[model samples]
Target: MAQPTTSLLCTGLSFEWPDGRPVLDGFHLAVGPGRTGLIGLNGAGKSTLLRLLAGELTPTSGAVKAAGEIGYLPQGLTLDTGLRVDEALGVRAAREALHAIESGSTDQRHFDAVGDDWDVEERARALLDRLGLHRLGLDRTTGELSGGEAVLLRLATLLLRRPDVLLLDEPTNNLDRAARERLYETVAGWGGVMVIVSHDRELLQHVDQIAELRDGQVTWYGGNFTEYERTVAAQQETAERLLRNAESDVQRQKRDLAEARMRLDRSASYGRKRSVTRNDPHIVAGKLKRQGQETAGRLQGMHTERLEEAKRKLTAAEEAVRDDAEIRIDLPRTAVPAGRTVLSLDKVRLPHGITADLELRGPERIALVGRNGAGKSTLLRTIAGELAPLRGEVVVPVPLRHLPQRLDLLDDKLTVVGNVKLFAPGAGDNAVRARLARFLFRGGRADQPAGTLSGGERFRATLAALLLADPPPQLLLLDEPTNNLDLASVRQLTQALAAYQGALIVASHDVPFLRGLGVTRWLELDGELRAVDPM
Candidate 1:
């Protein structure tokens, strides 16, 4: 394959948090002109790298060089709700200049501002239409748009900028299926150097290469996400094999060392016995003993060195093996009887003109899905009793828990165990710690402050607190739980939910994840609840 032109480069990059927690140390990366999917575990500094490349963040040491202008879309994008769509798209000044010039203003500044963007509005509108945001007129304020729409709008702004280097972090987190498809198409058609930090498998499929950030280094994998997985799997297999071989070698070395020690002891004993039997002279016997001792010492040193070398190889091999732990919890307490009524919603009218009426029984798994701004979250919040229905009754006789997208339930100041204890006040520390261990927060990990956790760790902590509550949640509500989650974290969550015996209503746009949930029913929330075929 031909090498692409280098569009972005980072050399000797280093960064640390305010608290002296090192994130990246002497990291180096060079991205060329093509779509590169940047993937890693939650706190691997993928986002931080993008920020450094975009100049949004300054590295503690090293340099970032970009061939041209850089456009960045952060993971947690929060637009100024007061700004107009045109302003957000960064074309407001150009549009105003064009309008002023057309109105017969001969201002030099207007001409200067409109220099080459006379058709800026037309281009902006066209881009908006392409992103499914045409209905959101340029005059509309950002407050009118949904979270997904805001993400797309931010993307449109970057697209309009036409930068040579583009960095997008979790662009599809809030996007629905349709919006995600649109974003996927955009990624597929991206011409310049684009580096996307995302866990969206569909979006990753459009990338030309994968740049995995792990342990403060970048490992390049040619082709897309599937190819990356295959490559990594093969690499891991080889690593495991090497590790086994290394272990075998170490054992053999140990055996050889033991045998050598035995031989040395026998030789010493035989030498002593021969000297006694022969009645050799004292000086000769002493010399013989010293010679035997020297030979034994040399043999022992050689064997020890070999053993140490084998052990070092074993360590290296072990390091090559990946250990992405998954959540494994047995929550039998969360189980509901087959005929039990878990929840009931009657003529429930939620915000954003959404209405839902449904009855959940036993441990039915329902997948709630809809387009961006379709009020899927609203319905969930209403069902979770976080929001009051406009005009209807919501009832949940059984214990319930809600894992919102923001995961705000966790208190940052508290430790993971402390947070879980708060939810399950009656549970002793031993019990809470034992349950948290199942969530992968073992030993010292459970004592880490919630605020200091990585994205995946935070999710696990939040889930632990929710699932390990006093009265086990029989009906659990999860809103886009996979958003911002790494692939391993997603798998961990899937495993946890798989073992969950309670009824689940998960509002998510991740079709693969939803499918894996063994959803018994598919519901779409578009102004009202309606049964939909499995996506």
Candidate 2:
């Protein structure tokens, strides 16, 4: 048998919101050494349970037993990072500072009094190299760094502390392929127990085990994303079968009850008519009473069947999906234009701001491939006209729509509907809600604050606003559109994009999404203008 992880254990855990409805009811899970993926739809109590496990939030009814040191890397935690590159990486200096604090502050007093002499320089250098940050220099502040850079630095600091357990939330939300793969390698090699909550299917592929949270409970399955996927599909099929059976049973019972009531009604009326005529009164009354008993029995049976069928339906429906989004319907759409030049770029040099510039044109679907600082964002900016080229002008004939990798353009304080309306006005509430529903952000979700939405949810809202706009743009410039979308939502999005007749400029490292979208054109922005056929 595999050894159970010693540090973390939760038994019969339950947590309730202010309304007293349990979000986590009798949740049971065990955390052990090696990397594990926590899979669930957003708001399925995954984050809430994580917080309770990390000691950040207390469970309302049950206990969380954590016997080891814990370090938490929250989702999109780059906002509060005031550390320089060296400090963020916690190079040798932070470790030395720990030693100094242990050695009665002599080293600290010396380092504080004489700057780098207090061993800060040596410590910083060592940690920076260990984390591949020495190349970035120690003076760089995390606040101004790119999303990937900031996240990497944050991860390095968390690892430097070498806590016994690690809890990461959406660690690869905004990372490029190279960055995401690099993180996978790090997590695979880390020595402590790790619980990673992510909607990224690719990232989950690296996990040792997958624990799915649903219906206020946790179920663990051995293996990686592949196994988890198979399990979920099997559950869905079973749930569907149960639902069908339940519905059929309910309908049969209802029909039988209706027929029985008719018979009972006729028998009583006949008895009443006989009594009025003064004919066989005793026999007729006796028959009516017996008929009533049979009718009551039939009614009781009907009620029992109805209740059982209802329970089955409820369980089946819940098991089929963690939420209502699982119910898929046929989509309706209009036609698309047929133009040769969906998007064209002539002798266009991508701005050499972070890395390089390039001249490129997208045939059908194009992938913007590169590392974190390799100029994907810069190129997108140039194409979007957010950044003016230093030399040649790029031509964009098709109406272009871009959902930047970052939600920087979004007003954080606005409601979800408000954000969508900002991009597209004059749309009716029902129309806007329909768009949100297409993106799986419907119901009361429209009233949610953009800032409070999960990374995946925010990405969906942004795309919904852009794609649902009147006269859909012929050229779609997507910078990591799959960054935070859930599995079901991603599938829906993939289908929608696949059916689109316009051109696609996708700057993403998600090979699966690109493959599913049938990307034909491939471009790499290294330092100059060039293209490649990734066949």
Candidate 3:
């Protein structure tokens, strides 16, 4: 393949954690002017690579070269809550300078500070308005903004800079459907060299190409996310075919070796019988026997060598196949009868002016849709008994469990097995381990401290703990469960939920995921809960 022009380039890059765990080693990449979607499983160094490109973290070795100034919107963006909107956008000085000049101060320092940005306030407001943050005035503090709003505000700051290269990590993590759409549009219209690390499939669809980071290497694929998936699927099919052929070859070689040994044994028996029957001379017989033995050794060695080579080829073929494990488990105890009422809300008034009055029966799967700050999470929390409704009541007749967006349900100090055991005290270690294995936490993985796991691993651990609870929850509530999850992790979550035969209410902006769950009811929470058509 022809190399792309180097708008942004990194060569011989290497980095490691303080404890000497390697992440990127001698990694190299060159990206030209266009939008590129950087994708990989959690802990595959996507965020770390962005940090390196943005100059937040220094590489242990090698260098990064960019055509011009770089702008970065990190995954975990934390602005000082006390800062004003203008200050956060990095235009406070220019705005102050413009204000001084307007008041008739002709100081050269003011002109220098203002530079050519005489209309800084206007430009900032325009950018904010474009990003759906017009409600937030320049005087407003960042603390007043919601998480999704904060993300947009950060993007606005980057857009104002007009950097030559833009790098965004998980830009739509906390965004609701509307906010995510805004981001997707921005990504699609981006004109500079942009690299975005995100699991949001819709956002990825806007990219010109997909760059997958895996096993300390980068693989490039042309076109959008859908194209990438198609290419990968075809590659996997070929790999699987080669693996099967290799396995068959190994089996054939084994059979051939066994047959060769049997033939040699038969020849030795015949030679001994013929020598006794013919009464050949002792010296001649001895010489002939030695020659036969030497020939047999050579034949045996050749078959053994062939078998070993076939086995080696099989091993190599196996390595080529992908092994993205899926969650497989039976949750018969979690099943709810069709006529049973699992949960109900009566005139429930949650924070943010959300009022919901609804009843959930049987194994109804609900997709809760709304814009950011619309109290979707509040409703879920109230149903899970984590928050008290301002007015009215929430009644959950069956056992319930909630997987919050932050996935804070697991104790950081405890191991995965310990956390599950915490929820199921009556269950033995063996039982818990067996169940955890289905969640892809087998043996030593289950013993790892919860604090030491990656984003995907942490989600799985939390989910396992909740699903394997002593009573086996029949009503499951998930608040933005797909947030921060990679594509593979999202697939694992979907697989696990497929086996859940219970009432499920998932408040997520991930329409594809909700649709995959076979959502029976679509509810929109915009001040009032009402049924809506499937999105």
Index of the highest-TM-score prediction? 1
Model 2 has how many clashing residue pairs?
11
Clashing pairs in 3: none
> Could you arrange the candidates by TM-score from highest to lowest?
1, 3, 2
Ranking by lDDT: 1, 3, 2
Candidate 2 lDDT, 468-533, residue by residue in tens: 666566678898777655676677678877767677788877777778888877777667535776
Off by over 4 Å in 3: 1-6, 58-67, 76-79, 107-109, 425-430
Which lDDT value does model 2 have at 508? 79
- Each model's C-alpha lDDT? 0.89, 0.70, 0.88
Cα lDDT tens digits, model 1, 1-535, are: 1125648888999998665668899888888889999999877888778888889878999899988888899876788989999999988898999999999999999999999888899999999999999798998899988889999999999898888888898899889877888898988888889999988888899999999998889999999999999999999999999999999999999999999999999989999999999999999999999999999999999999999999999999999999977789788898899899999999988876777899999999999988888888777888888888889999999999999887889999998999999999999989899888888889877888787776667888898899889788999999999988888888878987999999999999899999999999999888889999988
Weakest lDDT window of 10 consecutive positions for candidate 2: 326-335
Candidate 3 local lDDT, 1-535, one digit each (tens): 1123439899999998654667799999999979999999876888889989999889999999987889999865678999999999999989888999999999999999999888889999988888889899998899877778889999999899888888998889879877887888888888888999888888899999999999999999999999999999999999899999999999999999999999999999999899999999999899989999999999999999999999998898888898877887588999899999998899999876778999999999999988887887778878888889999988999999999877888888898999999999999999999999998899778888887676777888898999899799999999888877799988878887888898899998888999899899999988999999999
Q: How much does candidate 1 score in TM-score?
A: 0.92
lDDT against true structure, model 1? 0.89
TM-score, prediction 3:
0.92
